[model samples]
Target chain A: MKFSISRSQFIKTLNDVQRAIASKATIPILTGLKIAVSETGVTLTGSDADISIEATITQSDEKAQLLIEEPGNIVLPARFFGEIVKRLPEDQMTLTVGEGFQTTITSGTSSFNLNGLDANGYPHLPEIDAENKLTLPADILKQIISQTVIAVSNQESRPILTGVHILVKDNQLLAVATDSHRLSQRKLEINNGQGLEYDVIIPGKSLTELSKIITDDLEEVDLRITENQVLFTAGPIKFYSRLLEGNYPDTDRLIPHDATTTIEFNTQKLLASVERASLLSHASQNNVVRLVLDPEAKEGTIYSNSPELGNVQESLAFENLTGEKLDISFNPDYMKDALRSFGPTDIKVAFTSALRPFTLVPSEDEENFIQLITPVRTF
Target chain B: MKFSISRSQFIKTLNDVQRAIASKATIPILTGLKIAVSETGVTLTGSDADISIEATITQSDEKAQLLIEEPGNIVLPARFFGEIVKRLPEDQMTLTVGEGFQTTITSGTSSFNLNGLDANGYPHLPEIDAENKLTLPADILKQIISQTVIAVSNQESRPILTGVHILVKDNQLLAVATDSHRLSQRKLEINNGQGLEYDVIIPGKSLTELSKIITDDLEEVDLRITENQVLFTAGPIKFYSRLLEGNYPDTDRLIPHDATTTIEFNTQKLLASVERASLLSHASQNNVVRLVLDPEAKEGTIYSNSPELGNVQESLAFENLTGEKLDISFNPDYMKDALRSFGPTDIKVAFTSALRPFTLVPSEDEENFIQLITPVRTF
Candidate 1:
């Protein structure tokens, strides 16, 4: 393949696809990024077994300056070639492939000869029909991923739990993720809903990478779901991820509908207080902090103590406190995560008891997200 | 013990000493930070085996509004307590030790009861006489550390090579560090040297921590050396480091005096070119880059190649290339390090041959500092 393209434009496209480049060299060819030049434009593809990303640079209305001299395909080492092209000073870079799959890339006074593999050796990207596709704003997808992805389990013991379960009905989309210790559920309503309901589980890490590539500029993202693969396409970038093949657990039963006490507190203030308490508790354990609500005194106190270190107790102000007084302890990290996911300035925490899971959500609206944490038995 | 002080003041002092706190709990007591309160001031001390830092908050300081009701001492878990105090919201914090070494830390509505150890259990700071002392500008000391510390060997096989050798003779102070493959030597002359001549080896890690604590704005730092300990005192912070007890290797012989060729180049441009070349060579068995000076062409070229990956060649414009035309290959990482340590805008690189070590120094001032990197045989 022979082509010359703008350095920034190429770098941006390469970065989008580079995330899917295989970190583990199980298949040596998988570590290379496949580049193809056609009459339309240049396409870059990178993939591991689980996730694959393909980004295209087209001479479209965006006014991208690209010259296509020959139509062909080749695969070059992803990391090395990417770095070399990025460091080249020229605004436009030229790439040409010759006999024995040798590729020469030149920019200004810098030139690189890279050993390329035959593009035929690389695995083909799974093709997905656009019939069963959903469209949503990129910002909404990014928010859904950020709000719930952190709750996904990193361990592969229960492979399904490592993925975020997405459920859609009518115009509402629900994303839920849990590691048994903590759970996060986010809900969003999109206008362009296909009058169909579907459920799919996509790996949490895949969603994270997809979110990074989607900027916050309110771009439309088309999501296509096939039997075994899911495709997210935005602009000229198309991302394909292998779907988790299993039944997601019924997380509806885990969220409590009733609570003995509910209190409204300032989000930032409570978060800072919890962070301070965590510092002390983190010494003894993985940083567990306790919260005690005294309805009679109309006060909420956060306490954290390390037997070998020291203890901290802080009283937090609450807008409203009702129901029986309660004292509960849980991992501060879990609470911190829950607090961070909260959107509004004020958050309402509903507690069942000291030993049960508690829900934290925005005080004004329940449409954004809800985070639940299981309290630890500090006593 | 009872005292109330500004949270910011306490946090600042804690941060100053926290760097010396032991990360690993090999010695249980070493993980604790000792806090001693007296009528004059409050002192915080943290130490690992390699380095110890003591920072004082004097009652007389305008910024510190300390109320010392009782004088006492206690040791609290270093990392945890430091985090807790830093996160506390109140401007003023109070500390009180009740019966049975139960330390209570309170700020605003937050209070912490941390289990503290007897101050007597904490290791005492080494006592070093100030008789044999060398005073130098803190900025100079910091510059010396930054220039040579990276070359120190991390391996414990040659214990002396893990430290930076500091030699003081008359009014000249010389610092040298090497990991056998590469050596960096820097020298500075001071007026008030007191005619004292001494050689001491300070661990590179200790010096790094000291460098962080010493502000560049400070006029001078008092360096006192004892039998086994070295002390650096500037302003309210006192840093003590254990000296390595081995003779450093003679590095003077390794620096080549006569060179076959010398070239002057812009430091930043050379650094950027080397960095780009390094991206390709870093993946190879020998991370080497070759610089070929062509006097007739009035240009220089930097080349790096990895047989399994690819090869990169870039032309660099040299301000002046004299002596014999040369082509030398060396580890790109060492060259990058040497270039980064170049304090001047223009650097002169003197090469003896393709195998011998070359020296890199300021193009204008050769007396300030010099860094030497040994060439690697690419064949």
Candidate 2:
């Protein structure tokens, strides 16, 4: 490939595609990045059998600084190419592929000649029917992914639970994740998804990587789903993730609809209190922290005690308390994660009983998101 | 014991001593920090059998905010205590040790009760004779330690080589370290130890930890050496490190006096070029890079080639090249390290021959420090 491009733009595109490069691939070529230069621009592709990413730089783009001297295709080792491009001494670099797949990259006083593989040996991107297409702001997808991904089960015993269950129907997109201990559900209204519903489970790992690559610049992202894979197009970058095979458990029935006790507190204040209470508990085996709500006192106490280490108790000030006094214990880490993603000034914490799952909702946006955490029997 | 101290000051002192605490200590008591509170103030100590560090906070120091209500001594788990003190919600925390060594730490609306062990189980610091003592500014000691420590051998095959050999005699302080392939030596004129001379080897790891605890506030640090241990007192912190036993190799004869090829180049420029050249070479078996200097052409080229991957060549511009045409291969990482530690606008690289070790010295202050790197034979 004979092309001179702005080093900054090339580096950005390389990073986007590298997200799919496997650290250890069964097919050796999958570890390499495919670079194709044409009259239009250059396209970089990386795939790890399951996930694939492609990023394009066009000559018409002002920041691309692209000059097409020749059109060619080659594959370079992803890691070596990444390191060299990042450390190139100049703002612009030129790449020219010679006979026998020898590629030379020159920038400033530095020159690198790398052994490239034949691009024909690399697999092509899968062609998926774009009948079920949905368009949403990149930031909205990024937020929903982050809010629910953390609750996905990390254990391999249940492969289905390792993926976030995403459902779209009636113009609303719902994302839910659970490890059976804690569950998080987020809902957002999206356009162009009406009457065309898709119920697919995307591996939490892929969504996590996608969230990192997606910028928060409010650009619209087009999502297309196939029977086996889903494609996301953000700006000039295209990301594809394979769907997890199996039926996701119905988690809607698990969320408690009624509460016996509920209290409203500042999100930050409650988060800090739980974090402090978790200090000693995290060092213990159970990692449990208790929440003692006293309606008469108009305050709640977060307490944790580890027999070998010590005990920690923090008083959390609340705006209001209702229902009967309640005492419940749950894993502090789950509560911390749920509280961190709540986007509101205050959060309402509701408890059904000491042994049942509790629900936390942002007071300002109660209808959109709900996080449920099963309480541990500390007694 | 009962006392309330400034949280920030307490946290700083805790961090300073915690560096000596072992991640998994052989002696269970050593995993805990010994905290002693008295009328004067509080003292915290951490030890890992080989090195011990103690930091004291005095009531007279206005920053301490220490109010001693009672006197007592106890040991608390180092990691837990550190985390709690750092995350406390108030500017000041009150610590009280009650019956059975149950300790309570209170700050704002938070309270933590930690199980404490009897302080009598902690090991006592080794007493070192002060007959041979040298005093210097903390910043100077810090600089000398950092400059030479990186060259110390990390392998345990030669335990003595893992320590930096320090010599103070004739109003001069000298520090030298080497790993058989590269050597770094730094010298400074001092006022103390005019007639007293002591040669001791301090473990590089110990010196590295000491360097972090010692601040650059111009405070004087008193260093005392004994038969088996060395003690450093910087401000309110006392650091003790076990000396490495064995004779240090005589590295003075290893430094060449004359050079047939010498070139001066900007330290930063050469460092960047060498770092870039090392990228591919570092992944290869030999980690070698060739330097071809042509005095007639007034330019030098750094080239590295790997048969399996690719090749990289960089042309370096130098201010002056007064040397015969030379082609030599060496480890670029070694050169990068030597260049990074040199403090000057320009550095002079001197070579006696292709096989012998070369010396890199600061062009401005050539007498104070010298770094030697042995070249690897690429043929």
Query: Which model scores highest in lDDT?
Result: 2
User: fnat, candidate 1?
Assistant: 0.94
Clashes (N, CA, C under 3 Å) per candidate: 10, 0
Docking class of 2: medium
- For candidate 1, write residues B1-379 as lDDT tens digits: 9999998878878998999997676778889899999988899999997788999998898788998989999988788778777777889989999998888888888888888889998888898866867888888888899999989999998889999999999798889999999999988887888888879999999999999988856888999998789999978999999999978888888888888888898888888889989987888887889989877767799999888878889999678788787788989898888888884489888898888888888988887778888888766
Scored by TM-score, the top model is 2
Question: Model 2: chain B TM-score vs. truth?
Answer: 0.97
Once model 1 is optimally superposed onto the true structure by TM-score, how far is the C-alpha of residue B234 displaced, in angstroms?
Answer: 1.5
Evaluate all candidate structures by whole-model CA lDDT and list the values in order.
0.87, 0.90
Per-residue lDDT of candidate 1, residues A294-318 (tens digit): 8888988888776756567788978
TM-score of model number 2? 0.97
Q: Give model 1's DockQ, 2 decimals.
A: 0.70
Which regions in candidate 1 have their CA more than 4 angstroms from the true location? A61-64, A285-289, A354-356, A376-379, B25-27, B296-299
Candidate 2 chain B lowest-lDDT run of ten: B336-345
The digit string of per-residue lDDT tens for model 2 on B44-65 reads 9999989999989999989888
